[model samples]
Target: MMAVALVLSAVPLGAETLILGTTQVPRHFNGAIQSGIATMMPTAQIFASPLRYEDDWTPRPYLAQSWEVAEDQLSVTLHLTPDATFHDGMPITSADVAFSIRTIRDNHPFASMLAPVTSVSTPDPLTAIIHLAHPHPALLLAMSPALMPILPEHIYGGPDLADNPANLKPVGSGPFRFVEYRQGDHYRLERNPDFFLPDAPRLDGLIVKIFSDPMTMLLSLESGEIDMILLVSGVHDIQRLQAIPGMQVSDAGHEAIGPLNWIAFNMGKPPFDDVRVRQAIGFGIDKRYILDQMMAGLARDALGPIAPGSPFADAGIEPYTYDPVRAADLLDAAGYPVGADGLRFTARMDFIPGVPEQGRNVAEYMKSQLAPLGIALELRSAPDFPTWAQRIATHDFDITQDNVFNWGDPVIGVHRTYLSSNIREGVIWSNTQRYSDAEVDDLLARAATEPDPEERAALYARFQHIVVEEAPILFINELPLYTAARAEVTGLPQSIWGAISPYLTLDREP
Candidate 1:
């Protein structure tokens, strides 16, 4: 009953086709933007080597044959494999490596990931030496996704590629080539015959199908129209997918699932501008109620910015508990008084419904908590994504439901959010609360420059402590990252780091 499309009539075997389903095409393909595409096209090798492996959340080599660090741990040198080549049969050189890092810094798209690099140089044709402004122990982990996904220097000259023809149709060194892209619908990729890996990328082609709604995507999976779904909608979505017959489910709980959901405050605004108010709000909401009523008790309450599974996560810091009396007292001390109508001064919280049910469910739970403290809680809902983005950028409301995309590294996700420079242009810039603390910024800066793992962890712990006490945000549930595929697919390894390789050894049942 399976529909197999044969692309090569000359090949002895039937062509393998895979239909991959997702809620949306990636927001950005730049590795710095996110890792969705890299997971799908693993055949593309990087110069620095993968910092985290598919099996473990630890670092591993991909393109770098071997690497050595100075005794002072200030400089790191990477030697490229002689046989490693791009999809176009171009031997990747040290020049290409230097260009890749330089491009990331010059271009704004990769600013999030590449801003930490102090300098990159090539001492030899096949060797790359990178120097950081200071010792960065986590530099290896930070480079894993962005710096490792090396781009050909010749493709886009050291400038913005927004208007470049390559942006629409990119040519990667990955095992797959971009065949066709139907905007807002689906994109097709064909295997690269010139791929470097041997006996890799078993599928002849891959089709990434985007659905407007989860129900339609689920129906496609039930009807065998698609082989798998990438992102999970919610806890119930996982339950529903598992119920489907003849399907395999892979769920790597906390680390892969990403950070717990939380509420972001517009710290630039009044009331929340006060640390006490922020702390009161953090203590006011009963996380247990939301867990039971909204998330179906699937998530654990996050104690701090770093989730529990992270290596840098600090467990000694006590988590804030719900106390209505304390919340009301804090509100009173902050100069907000309850009127005759019993409604204390409160601002409207803006939330966008990703799926119709999720918005209404979470908003109502938040409303219940505020009502008890004599706060006039109002909900402003946006039905779609564009509208939501606009509202958050303009700081149109008091608070919003948001989640940080943590790719196993704590610094990449948390540090930027707490930085002040990122709060410009109305967009949250990851700093949803627009929080600006000199001490917190100092800790983050020191952590980035400190190459010692112990020192970095200590600095980060101090930063987390400040945020926890200030409570600019309320920590929420860490959603599960899951993969549901057809039973025939094999050799696809399970990973907690969230860096999956679809091109690795997966094959269909004969």
Candidate 2:
């Protein structure tokens, strides 16, 4: 606890208020029912999980003072900190821990992350024992705030937890307390007086301003109307903002482990069903050009679903280099020759919005590049994120541009993209491509429970090889996540996951 107190000392008391900007408004405050960085970023500050991950991706205790795993790996027991209390003044107890674990296991979009846990039992107010059906190597990592936000049992333990009114006005046991939320405007939070950590949350309050237009958000940051911009601006804007005198821009150390953008083909649809067609499209697109011209060299060419920096990434795999001639050959050999109209097939390419014009630029580039191979790609744009996600969930497009934010572990992040069981209707952002392989599924399943680190890494390496060969999605590039703030802001956390939780330690200089 002395180390924790030392970290809190970085933010002095005089640093009173902080204002941040975002393009996406939170749809709900409940972490269990919602799935997106927009919602998670805000809710993370309001709730306290038993465990969290450090920048190195190792588990660290938060609400739970300490924990132990049985030698058989069948159960884990957590000891809670006696002094911790929720924002509502209720003492945090083992009942809240057990309730949150069970609720999230049933409702979260990545519920598969907790598939190993069979039940939770509370022997006392400060003790919770979790029973597992099998060994799960990454269980602690999965308990990070992003995956398992511990909710108050009294507030969210009802039968209709998802529809609870507390979702709009949340109360939790974190360093911040909810103050107010004005839809499409801003959400405000103040420091939690009863927060267990001493001299924490140096800022008196936090304000997250919502702006639909990214340019407006940038302007706000530049004008000092907003002190920071969290996750909205693009790389191009970030580069420009860095030149300003009082602004500070950095990737926050997430470039090595961020989301990789790709073109996901609907395997349930025709043309995409053919492995040759998928391979042809992969070879046709010039990812290097996209990285240079469209991305401003802020991204790296990705050959597989897992980024190169991850432990599970396959070093032997190579990206499908840009070869239009080979692309044409594959299309012609597949019996789709150049017709009198000089077109092999016509298909629509759907683009997800909120990418700050990069999505449209990439779509246009793909259209021009694919034309030489006798492919006609009609561009379509979804009005908003929800509509765009629905199109992906329903398999309503031929090809779509999408990305997955890897949750530090492949089991929680990469598995959903290719797992056969994840191809359910209305489940947005999973394996909507519907590409399934028995061997790959088995590897993913085994990797989840493999206790040995080397053994788990080997399993995922094989899984990566299989997915790359199948070409379910056209692996593109890993984009760097940038955060720009005033020079006065300091000690902000930086990582692929828990991007916003650093706000707890952030302090502003007057």
Candidate 3:
């Protein structure tokens, strides 16, 4: 059950190279810092000992040969494969695995996922034990995805590791190793000489060319400058690129089955503190119009916290249709009257400047829908991500547009966005709405540790029900899946879990 790389008849494997294009370049290589690590280090593997991950997010054997969960399920022990070695010729060890977990928990900027871990212990040279303060039913799922990237802690520790050039030149124990990085131009990687697997990566090296715009990137793909187009930001661009003659389109569909878009209301403010105003805002958004016009009908209109494909997604939570009379009636009842300009006295929305063109389309649609209800929607763009984040934390805007990314677990969306702990230290990424509900929190606590599938599903469904009724955030449409590869590339099957298509498995066009 392994894939071998093959080449076009005339091209030799060692001489073959593949070029990849993406519309946007990631800001950093640190996996925790951003969502782009899997793109950058396609060959890298996480160091979760015996628990290896397959493409479908099921656990298999990788650097870790195998693992066992104690009968109580309170702990898990892993055995590392002796064959595995880092690119620097260091043998993979249990200490490295322990250190990797600690590094992410102690120093990684995005530690929200792993903050629950109490301790990691290396009882022997080849085995590591993870003791949990509480049994996590989602542990297997978390270990399979974002929370499990393995690092060589021996290299990444101390101030030197913190400031090391190796952050960019990552010597991963994957199928490929970083070769060269030309700022704003291209980053290149070659086959890892230390790779443990046999009969491996067919291509000689992989080149990731960064194009500033989608049109340029698509053109590069057609001209053979780039072999594949990784991700397109909007539906219009996806359609245009698919029309290109030789290129093949693969639709992976909605990357995450959780809420992708949410229209956030600042509950710390006056009107939003009232559930009626929040519900009015929800009813005012013409989601169907936005999905049809802006997203080319490629978007799924959402009704609750979970998307349609999510296991916990319940259809019973009804969405409010755009009825101007109903929207205006709710606004009037909330004591917001039409002013001299025939606009409800509403405040402006703050959005990050230079946001994808889709944000502008959404804002324009909101303006049209709210205008009929006599609501004035002022759209203002902040300078950058940090600036926009700062404004959001300070509750400097009445409304904002945000796409909450989560991997189907309700806790990822529920706790981070509406829970009380997220409001700490002027840093509010998830909980921008400042929403809190005692009953919702109680349901969340129950859902977190409840192992019974039926029970947890019931608990989360209740939480989602409360969230929809309270309406702190306006649920928006989720995008349809799409991935493109030149006709020659092979080995990719459609995945249900939808972790960004594994880059290591992609081969040269045959």
Candidate 4:
């Protein structure tokens, strides 16, 4: 049975309860400070944003009732709802919106996202005008439910932003309130009766059950124990869940969070520092095979950082086709020759620890594929996600497998990983490869502020061509992420942000 402790006393009789399942563990409970599915999925419900998104990528009013862009495109004026109040009964005002925007810029991993914002001027308690240093075409996208969760300044104004007490015990103006969290088990949330939006959050409460084993979670879903499972990546299980009688599985929700899984090189290292070596490695591996066989034809081959689904993606860019002979020749030209021991060189390969489909299985496949190129591989194992993240952030591995996202726009997700200016130490997702190209940086900079869409796209195409040649990352298959839910679960989020949206209309059949 779904946990009813939170729903029983708080809601009226016959109110429905929502139960979700996930294997991923969050680093913390703040979406404004953290990225990725683990934290964003849950925190997005607990903390609301100025706007929510629809499946067509249309911006819908949420906490902020209406907003208008300045005629010069240098500022965005937000008119917040006067009735919106945090869970603690504190009125959410324009000041909180200003504070939240500034906080996200300073602490969030997407370094270039809010960097253009000069300041936020609060003309009134209901109006906040965001002043920008330049025209930011993707600024509104930065305020999406998942990307920007408005935090209460009065609660999170203390010294340590990351270590704030309110992160665990959050006080927000969202449809839900953080009730409790028991590690390695479940997270419970209660509906906020005083929510700003009327007739919102049809469900009385929510229970997110944490499972170490996804198979068990699937079985639970089959038995009607779990109402839904967010970001389900198990290939066979996805098919299995789809075939079940009373279950629904679809990847429609993740258009904004464009996920791609590929191999990342530490450019600070010797062998990977050479473009030929990286290119050789790319040529050695069969991307088509990974997409067709390993991924069960669920994913499409990714050529560059921009998602294939994005309007900005350049299909004209050259791709590294499977050619082992060419790969060996390049390796030979790079001064590595097969020794009497039958190996030309040795390298250590690591991967993100969770999800066997994307982790150990792919790493082992890479090891086997590279073995034919006279490369002896040592597959390094991480005990958990945090350990692997630390290794990547510190640039401790020679080569590793990684999964990244476009996050609705290139400015929010793509620029952070490729820009030299964002090569911040200890930041996991920001330029860990130490890649620095003035041309690439300049192209990205120009694209971020360019007013004309055509000019912006042209600049991105140029960036893609240069970066693909540099080969800091060997492009692989785009991840096909899905959300599995029981048929009874209605009003499932259909937005580009997917499971991370503020589900105000979530309901269940009696």
Which candidate achieves the best lDDT against the true structure? 4
Q: Kindly report the root-mean-square deviation of model 4 from the true structure over all alpha carbons.
A: 2.8
TM-score of 1: 0.88
Candidate 3 structure quality by residue, lDDT tens digits, 231-309: 4556876788678786777756333334366678888888778898888877887777777777887667777777776
* lDDT, candidate 4, 1-510, per-residue tens: 433334333433336878788887776788888877888887788888898887766788887899999888899999998878888999999999999999988888776789899999998999999999999989888888778888899999878998988777777778888888777777778888998888988889888878888888888888877788888777888889888987888777677788878789999998888899999998998878887888898777798988887778899989899899999999999988889989988999998876678767888988899998999879999999899999999999899899988988899889988989978788788799999999999999899998788999999999999999889998887887787889888888877777888887778878
TM-score of 3: 0.88
lDDT of 2 by residue, 449-504 (tens): 88888998888888888788789888777766777888889867675463645356
Which pairs clash in model 1? 51-59, 135-450, 135-451, 136-451, 137-451, 257-481, 260-477, 260-478
Clashes of each: 8, 0, 6, 0
Q: Which residue runs of candidate 1 sit more than 4 Å off their true CA positions?
A: 1-14, 26-52, 108-112, 145-147, 158-160, 253-257, 355-359, 497-502
Two-way TM-score contest, 2 vs 4, winner: 2
- The clash number for model 4 is 0
lDDT of candidate 1 over 143-227, digit per residue (tens): 4533356666677454465455555565566656666666777667777676555776677777767777788887777777777
For model 3, the local distance difference test gives 0.66
In angstroms, how far off is 502's CA in candidate 1?
A: 5.3
Full candidate order by TM-score, most accurate first = 2, 4, 3, 1
